[model samples]
Target: MQFTSTPRGARLARRLVSHRLDEWGHPYDSAPNETLTLIAAELAANAIRHGHVCGRDFHVRLIECTSKATTVLRIEVADTRTERFPSLETPTPPTVDDESGRGLFLVSQLADRWCVAPRVGAPGKSVWAELELNHG
Candidate 1:
């Protein structure tokens, strides 16, 4: 899904992702739906806030890759900023009475696996996260 690269775009991304999850049989309040929605909102907001390059907008793609034994939902957010990739191995932010800097930690808890990669065949970066579906 394409977004406007503004605050409204970030909001729309969250809502669109929720709607898509619902369409995929995960209702808005379900565990997976809620987790994806929260991750989408935070990542999209970060893309807009930290990766915006003037009029260039960000894009979000949700994909499900499955085999006989497992299914994974991949959440990818791409932005136009080539140098704004996140460093996951960086040290954690200090916790001395802070009101900010906790998004990635939350993501680490929700996502089974997540990483940032330079966009292949493009000039931007993509932050991708995966959640494993409950197969039981």
Candidate 2:
């Protein structure tokens, strides 16, 4: 889904992610649901604050894959700014007093795997995270 580059849009993206996960059988309070929702929130907020371009919007895509042993949910947030890709290496630890710069750090901690890549057929980049859930 595409969203305006604003806080409200970021918020909506998060809500929709949670709702969609619920539809996919992860309840609102389930670990997969809450974790992915928070990932969406951070990524969407980062897209708005760091990736925004005038008159341009951001996009979010969620994909679920199920196997006999596990389920994987991949969240992708693509934005129109190409110059500000997050570091592929470990994110530097933010200072205690720093109020920002921890979004990707949190993502790294929560997601089983995450990365930044060039958006396919697009001018910007996509930051994506994947969480694996065991069928229980």
Candidate 3:
């Protein structure tokens, strides 16, 4: 899905992701569903705030893979600013009083694995996170 690089766009991205997760057998209130949605929201917001290029939009892709052992949900958000890559290596937690700067930190805590990569053949970067489903 493609969205304009704005607050409204970020919100729409999160909502759509929630709906998709629900359709994919993960209920809206499920732990994995909620966590992934929040992760999507943070990445989308970062794309808008840091990766936004005038008249350019960001993209979100959701993929699910299931195996005998586990099911994994992958979320990718791609934006048009190649120079402003997400710092997955050293995402230090923000101070308690700081309202911002905590998005990536929360993602690292919630996602089983997450990273930033160059958007294949695109000028920007894609930030991706994966969550392994609980079989119980």
Candidate 4:
């Protein structure tokens, strides 16, 4: 799904993810759905705040894997700014006490694995993450 690089876009991404998760059998109140929504919101917000390129929008995709003892949920967010890849540690938010610079930290806490790669056939990068779903 493509989303404009704006706060509205970020909200939309989170909401749509909730919808998709519900369709995938994880209702909005379930752990899986709630987790995915948080991941979507953070990734989408970063895509808008850091990866935005004027009129270009970002794309999100969800891939499910159930073969493992725990299910694997993959979230991919692609944007048009390849140079502004997310940093796992270094966040220069211009100030020490600022409320920013903790997005990836939260992502790390939630996602089992997360990384950024060049967007296939595009001039940007795709920030991808995987969440381990609880089978019980």
Q: How many pairs of residues collide in each model?
A: 0, 0, 0, 0
Which stretches in model 1 have alpha-carbon errors above 4 Å? 90-96
lDDT tens digits, residue span 1-136, model 4: 9988999989988998889889988899998889878989999988998999998999999888897478898899999997887765533434567678777777777888988888999899998889887666
Candidate 1, after superposition: displacement of residue 43 in Å? 0.7
Give candidate 2 misplaced runs (Cα > 4 Å). Answer: none
lDDT of 3 by residue, 1-136 (tens): 9999999999999999999999999999998889999999999999999999998999999999998889999999999898988765858979989979988998899999999999998899999999997666
Question: TM-score for every candidate vs. truth?
Answer: 0.91, 0.97, 0.96, 0.89
Can you tell me which runs of candidate 3 are displaced by over 4 Å?
none
Question: Per-residue lDDT of 7-120 in model 1, one digit per residue for the tens?
Answer: 999999989889998998889899889998888988898898889999899999998777777778789999989987788774276496977667776777788998988888
**Among all candidates shown, the one with the greatest TM-score:** 2
Cα displacement (Å) at residue 1, model 2: 0.5
Judge candidate 3 at residue 19 and give its lDDT. Answer: 98
Model 2: what TM-score?
0.97
Q: How much is the lDDT of residue 113 in candidate 3?
A: 96
Query: How high is the lDDT of residue 94 in model 1?
Result: 45
Q: Can you write out model 2's per-residue Cα lDDT over 12-81, one digit (the tens) per residue?
A: 9999999999999999999999999999999999999999999999999999999999999999999999
As for model 1, its CA RMSD to the true structure in angstroms is 1.6
